[model samples]
Target: MTSGLVSPKRPRNLAERLVGEFTREIRQARLRPGDRLPTEAQVVRRFGVSRTVVREALSQLQAAGLVETRHGIGTFVTMNRRDSGLRADAAEIATVVDLLAMLEMRIGVESEAAAIAARRRTDEHLERMRAALDEFERLLGAGETTEPADFRFHSTIAAATGNRYFASFMGSLGTKAIPRAHLKLPDLPSLHHRDYLASVNREHEDIFNAIAREDADGARAAMRTHIGNGRERLKLRQESSDNLEPRRKK
Candidate 1:
């Protein structure tokens, strides 16, 4: 039997890494509902990580409804495991409504993030965002998935907010914040896919420019427009898929 829990290479964010492993175990049924996870010490030792990492991972699991922690007791898998953490839930967000709702959340959270990043970002933050963007474009040129670079771009903005909470929230969402990472429908034609990705890169460039110029309002507006446009594209694609379904029956 295959275990979905893979040890993260170069685990920079131990908490999120642990979250993925434990989430994988739960979703794979290796850690079933009502099963108490290993003690914090055991988890640290077993994973060769820290207690803080274990606790943070458990906290995120509780937030995601995958686990529950009882005082002086232990953390147990909850019956409400609707997802295998955030990233894996990408495959499950198949409907336009779900995609739109996720975008709505992003608009509220990331618009402010971008605005703050514009006002507060340092040279280092700007450099990181630029690097991520460059890598995203290069990966696209190679026809590779741009999810990691795309996510890093957004996370850098969140980090630039100078608020750990913003960064942590983005980290918890993982790659699910990237609309293209989820919203799986029928594939766009090759030309359309290339154009779509290019448009997304252009949007990223707009955000980068606004932040670089220290235009807070411009940054916020750009982020909103980017997310809103992505939502509209998903809606159109979903409608197209629905339309094709009726024709396929005929």
Candidate 2:
């Protein structure tokens, strides 16, 4: 009979270590969409790991939708350039088409989220929403940026919908959405006309009112109308831009 014995040297656990490094780099956003990642051998050299460990780490990133490998080309940090959800851009030659696609996606998500929140919201959730709304108005009235409040408002709605996944996704993405939403809001101080903002404020109130009443149908309708109104306004703005199209116009 042979006695069992432990190995003197411990395994490096290279896969775990490589994954940690990769996760850190990706999270720091040093590796953005379309960014190329190092090759398998290159990754191994960087991590001081064997080839298998590098492959495992890369595979994990791929599974997480954080990266992709081309058949003959190198791996990329981000696979889906359309991850932003809104499709509009003028930087590229084909940006206008993409922007339209993006807006369509935003319309679908915002409308549905609103509808669902109506059916599911609780008093605590409404309180959270009101808090966010108050913060937004307070800051905006004070001639300061209200980005924090803006994020919280959307975040609260997503949470109120009783879907943890939706809430998490919104929290992750709301920072990007708010800046764009702020741009879409018509100028008040600059134009000296607050009607546009007032209108939006009313829409928000109508949404809250429906949710507070537990009027699921009303909430859905309110949210759908609100999202549709935004889309229509954006479309009209686009048409207005066409009327004054300078050569450099986005």
Candidate 3:
């Protein structure tokens, strides 16, 4: 009999059954470190599936960091290597998918940072925040890109929070594209009839007001509300686009 890795009577999709077989073999130590898996063809034969299905199964194992495939060779079990490639671009790609992943993170971090900065920002830090905010306003009004200024504003808040790590992570994100502008009440001719930006304005003002009043909790709450509002707007925009446009010419 084969390894009998799984009960032949298992109830699941073929891909799932393959995962189970691979996992069982791994757990039973039948598949050891550096063990090269049989070729995709062998898997096709064993699993009674096409090459495509075998590839999908191996892909799942690869995602789990349990196996790796060499271009010219075959798939092999990973002894100890961590899964670095699976989510390497998740943070970046999430922007396109969710439109709010970054803002959600900001709400969690910057909102609390706003609270801390309200209580702890030094004179210099306050000056920097003011400067950054001013630049943000200028760029936004000048019809120029405000992405950099927006980052500066958040970075200043992180600095004022008096936590170096906070600032560090915020800066780390700076290297990634910020989705704030995309989520902005876009300059859609359709949406321009009403004051869609009013909510956005209020949210920013609330955050600024909290900072001005040196109210910690208010700043945090305001920031969260602002981010949450943006997320909602993004959803609305996506929903509106669902059937609004005619099919594009191929």
Candidate 4:
């Protein structure tokens, strides 16, 4: 079947936009559980995106436990909205205030998790984090959606804490943990988007370096600073939007 998804006027991460479209369809009961999604080729034709983008979007849906792909068959919806008790809907997190609230929660939870991870992480955990960071950099360079890699990097840190609960908590947040994945901001200039993402990766590097060196205090500080910087950036964006509101109405 053809999709009714429409491309936005401004540029966005295509995979993320596809995910949002699929999510909306699923949540609205139009695509119920057990319904097969459009084939990857179909999706490519319908959305006018590359197969790579379609695969990435499907991978994210699988990661979120929303769909299961059967070998040689097709991807089918696995759950309805009510089945996931802890999901953070992008629609629900539409405002800057909501995003700030999420970051506030992350700052408290992740800082401690980073410290604990530094103390308890194994070689495998470090390798995973490194791979996630590498994937993040590659995707950013390719101008693809980096949300999966970003989520993987943070989730790896949580996993390194040697506590299943920490990992579970991060998994429950999923890509929603990366604010840029869903935040409803105006289209940013390409230079601005690249610079912003590069800055984020640098912060990720700091957190990784601290964890790799087993510096619990330093890791904790780095995590705090990373998340705090996100909070500040959102606040600044909010302020800028507020400043522009009057002119837009004229």
Candidate 5:
């Protein structure tokens, strides 16, 4: 059953978009737990994406434990037999905890990614990272959201790792990888917001500089610190809010 799963939009992030559509079907029970998914050919025709894109999308699904592909048969949903929703849930990133968990996962994957990027980055990779960093700064100055620029900056580092899978995995996480987009900590005082963004930009600079200088240990440390600080920032914000409430009540 097609279920109108097709999209006419030009291919931008085809695999991740397809993953979203498939997830909607599964969550809504349009495609139930054990039902077999459409064939690769059918998916290609419906989505107007290449076979390779379809395969990649399916591979992500398989990796998420949402579906299983047989040697010659077809891909089947694997949701109910196991806690298959974890991957889809992650991709959705619906809650604060989910976003925090995504950050933790990035800390594990991207700390090493930064180290490799530092060792492997070429002039071109450095240039791309610089461009992303510049754009982030420009957007931040304009009082605009920096989520896309932030994502590109991190993804550029992943690309510098000389591993397409690293980039692909980051791509699979999509824009949700930007914690600010998913988080709504009570607004810092205006000056505090400025300081916070400045600090964040400084962290970005540290990572970029380490990569440009080909300092693997520095890159890894910078990346770990950046993500770890973000986690703590949120945790502390939550704790402070909780502490303030009883005083306000009093």
Candidate 6:
């Protein structure tokens, strides 16, 4: 197994880094099917991460169907390197540039998805979306990142489209689809974090409200605006970073 410590330079969170490392090992055949992963303590020691981070990474691997944890035994690789249909690698999508590209793609895809959802969504679907938005607001108020709730809101929208493929596509992307999950938002000013997320939740409200009204065109436009704003935010952040680099080097 690769023993290199996870790099702090990456913007990804500890669990995401761990997931990427283990994923690379599994995909590279360094860890073959049925090969047991390091015990939780061993992983914690080797990676210099908390037990929580390790468990979260392992849970993601299990959810991806790449590994399985046996009762009282250990987590073992469940599959070899093979094409898993409709998957995006977290590592590939880690950078701001990559995230921008993803947002562009989402604008095209999810915009239509929202329109379809507006037409097809049942009362149950609207309730779930409202619940997700409520959870997101609660988390934001608690000063939590709210990525899970954010993802849940988008996933619920996809599910409301009444198309399994749309839901599957969102599931495949997972919480990584939420830009702030990888953006290191804590490094920014607290005001920026709070203000930006509040803006985002308001966008979520727009999307949800449009869908609830069964206004297909309005839902599509709102989804586009939401995702398009995300792309613009990434571009602005990148420009800000680039402008700061010269000052830092001076």
Q: Best by lDDT, which number?
A: 4
Spell out the clash pairs found in candidate 2: 86-102, 87-98, 87-99, 87-102, 88-99
Tens digits of per-residue lDDT, candidate 6, 27-70, equal 88899998999999999999899775676566456545667667
**Candidate 5 versus the native: TM-score?**
0.62
lDDT tens per residue, model 5, 1-250: 0011112232225666797799778878898877999998999999998765675566555544567666578889875534422122333454555566778888988999999999989897787678767877887788876666677678778767866567666655655566565445666797788678878889999999999999999999999999999888866765555322110111
The estimated TM-scores of all candidates read: 0.62, 0.52, 0.53, 0.65, 0.62, 0.65
Off by over 4 Å in 3: 1-91, 175-177, 180-187, 190-202, 243-250
Superposed on all Cα atoms, model 2 deviates from the true structure by an RMSD in Å of 18.9
Q: Ten-residue segment with the worst summed lDDT in candidate 2?
A: 1-10
lDDT for model 2 comes to: 0.56
Please give, for residues 6-100, the per-residue lDDT of candidate 1 as tens digits.
12233335566787898889878999989999999999888898664565566556545667666579889976545432232333434446557
Off by over 4 Å in 6: 1-87, 243-250
Total residue pair clashes for candidate 6: 0
Candidate 4: misplaced stretches above 4 Å?
Answer: 1-94, 242-250
Q: Name the lDDT of candidate 6.
A: 0.74
- For model 5, the run of ten residues with the poorest summed lDDT: 1-10
lDDT of each: 0.73, 0.56, 0.59, 0.75, 0.70, 0.74
Q: Of models 3 and 6, which has the larger TM-score?
A: 6
Candidate 3 local lDDT, 1-250, one digit each (tens): 1110112233224554676688789767799879999888788888797654565456446535567666678888877744232122323433234434655776777788889988987776666556656765665566654455455556667767766556546533442324443333324763462244444554666776678779998999888887777677666665655332211113
